[model samples]
Target: MKSSVRAVLGLAGGALAGLALMAASASAQTIAITDGRILTGSGIIENGTVIIRDGRIAAVGASVPVPAGAEVISAAGRVVAPGFVAVDSGLGGNEVSSQPEANDLRQSSNSISAAFDLSWGLDPWSITLPVARLGGVTRAIVVPSHPGSSGGHDHNHDFAGLGASGHHEPGLFAGQAAVIHLAEGTEIIVQPRVAMVAPFGNAGANVAGGARGALYTLLRETFAEVRLYARNRAAYDRGDVRALSLSRADLEALVPVVEGRMPLIVTVHKANDILMALRIAREENIRLILDGAEEGWMVADQIAAANVPVLLNALANLPGSFERRASSLENAARLHAAGVLIAIKGNEGSVHRAREARYNAGNAVAHGLPYEAGIAALTVNPARIFGQQQRFGAIAPGLEADVVIWSGDPLEPLSQPVAIYIRGVAQPLYSRGLELRDRYRPGQQPGLPPAYRN
Candidate 1:
């Protein structure tokens, strides 16, 4: 009798598992976007068609034949482009500011710990996701905030701490960054950790004895130690007889960074910080990318000569910091004209700013940057930086189907993505901001009374 009951339970479980598999299979269907003004992002395509099957772009061209019975989105008179990639923004997994437990971004007190992964900090359901998505941002490099010692100071130990200890510690935020696809499920969308971040600007100086010299010294010493660590890794791994007892956490955390496997993303706004960062990059033979380069226009030639790309905020024309004295609305265009590969980032620390990414790109075009290049900066350039160009950047064959259909030119202020695709699946455009507008503003649908519709 016991065996009979056990057999019945096993059969029921199997049936449920089979049903789940079927449901998943049904969700993964072939979709094709037809009859659109497709901006392939390699360039423009007039009245083009994109065929997607099983979440990958099957074909993209004016003459590509559409398959029968395929789900088609008629995008006539609409603009289609590869979804935008926000290089630097605090989007997903960073809600609930008062709750430090909810924010998983920065680490304080120490410097070196590369094993800290940012994927664990990501909140797949954050309200910020839809806000960015509505503006056509489909992927982002979710970076951690700078550790308290921004200028390369050692507050406690050199390497911040072990990943296990940092992961469990409370009230401290500092760790690694992870790339994420702005998709629904948290489990399947995480990309690999691509870079290790270091704060190297005025903030870094504040943390390092209020001196730029201290920050530079600390950074140099940290990298030197990392170089030694890499040289001795095999010996340490093998438990060699003369393995040195080194507890340098900063150096240890930079093993991947020093080897060029991971790029070092430095936060710097001033020309001096940019030059200093360039010196470090050349001296260490390490890969580097500059973030928050508000004054990058001042030394565009130098940056381009060094082959270091920049991520800049397009709408931040107000002079907030001394380093950004030359900050202008046309900074993006100027940098592009100087041959610097530009990636336009929305303003950090606020959700409202992210919604203006398209406007930011448009402003760049209005100044001097070509319209196509401006669009590519927001889309392909960022994807290339994050190492997802093949999958996420352009509308090409065999790429993930992350396409945005805009009501008009994407850069225009009134433009909005009417339809957005994430891995060939349609996503809802509803967000907290939109919901509030519907609830409070008088007029459409179930809003306030007719008298308030004015």
Candidate 2:
């Protein structure tokens, strides 16, 4: 049996402000979680005591002495682990999918939107954030997608009848992605422009003519221009430019991408295209993160050889399309076996499924992925890949207190977050769903409609 989630957030809009105050108050206090089965990401610490001070892990060990004036919470039979990191999501953006003005995830009006930073549109007060926090996800990488790219099931048809071939030119580059911290404050972005995104399979085919080859060619050409722009910046600024399809701003944004400073997160599903993407990564001398590599298991060795990490939808076993025909339940396990870093991402095209990352980890663990590896996929693996190793991930001393106490095995589907803490402060389990249920409680107001009762 699982315990109920801690409702740290109150049933009011001002709850966020209250949480901020709590964070401030907690910042000055030392918190100790003692006698818990701690999954330290590297290994387990049986009956460990994790001490947090000034919003960071002060010490972690089995016999760490509790300091005076420290607030101690005994986790006698609970499982404690670092909060899950949602690698690719639309967390800070896309609050309402149907409302275009509210959702700032993708800009379909332009194919070359490399300068379109996703952090500027981040909404910390989004309903999705608290829900995901309740699910034990404390950090996330909010990504932007190609406007016309066909992925994730849009059950509500939020993007129905939206073709990428409107006034916008269908090129390759989508935009920049942001790494976010789901703490209880307004500033959530950890690093902006962590990766520049591109599409390479059927979605790429849709955007860059009716062929996949064009997408690759256009991407290569863009990189080539980026190289030229890097070398001849002064000349290009004086109107003595070479052949360039992208603007100077975009070329400048992609400079880090080409120089291995920022990774290129390409959405390639087919094995053959994955191979091509690997080759591109090698030839261009850029770090790569393969997103949506549905057929990755087919060429696991090749991916491992390239030293490229793969971000996957761990539960994507059924054949959604021809590109994912080789998708298997053991894809994550096989890739891990082949020495590739596997990060569990959410479903393609869906922004609201960020919280399901832990469930995805559970599914992968059930399908033969090591339980530790599965947990690490949502923690250390992503943090290391995204260059946030020192600040986030793991439950080690000196790291941020992004930890969760689970009612049962965290990977088990039945288990849930009993308590969640981010940056040493406890997070709220409140959500729009809970608010609605409490607001429309039956018989609360028999003479009025449910909306008026509140």
What is the C-alpha local distance difference test score of candidate 1? 0.69
**Model 1 misplaced regions, further than 4 Å:** 1-28, 109-115, 147-174, 234-250, 350-352, 435-454
For each candidate, the alpha-carbon lDDT, in order, equals 0.69, 0.78
State every prediction's TM-score relative to the real structure: 0.82, 0.88
Best by TM-score: 2
Model 2 steric clash pairs: none
lDDT tens digits, residues 39-128, model 2?
998889999988888889999999998887676666768789998888778887888777878778776544346878989999988888
Best by lDDT: 2
Worst 10 contiguous positions by lDDT, candidate 1: 1-10
For candidate 1, write residues 261-352 as lDDT tens digits. 88888778888889999998999888989887878888889999999888877776777768778788888888888888888877654233
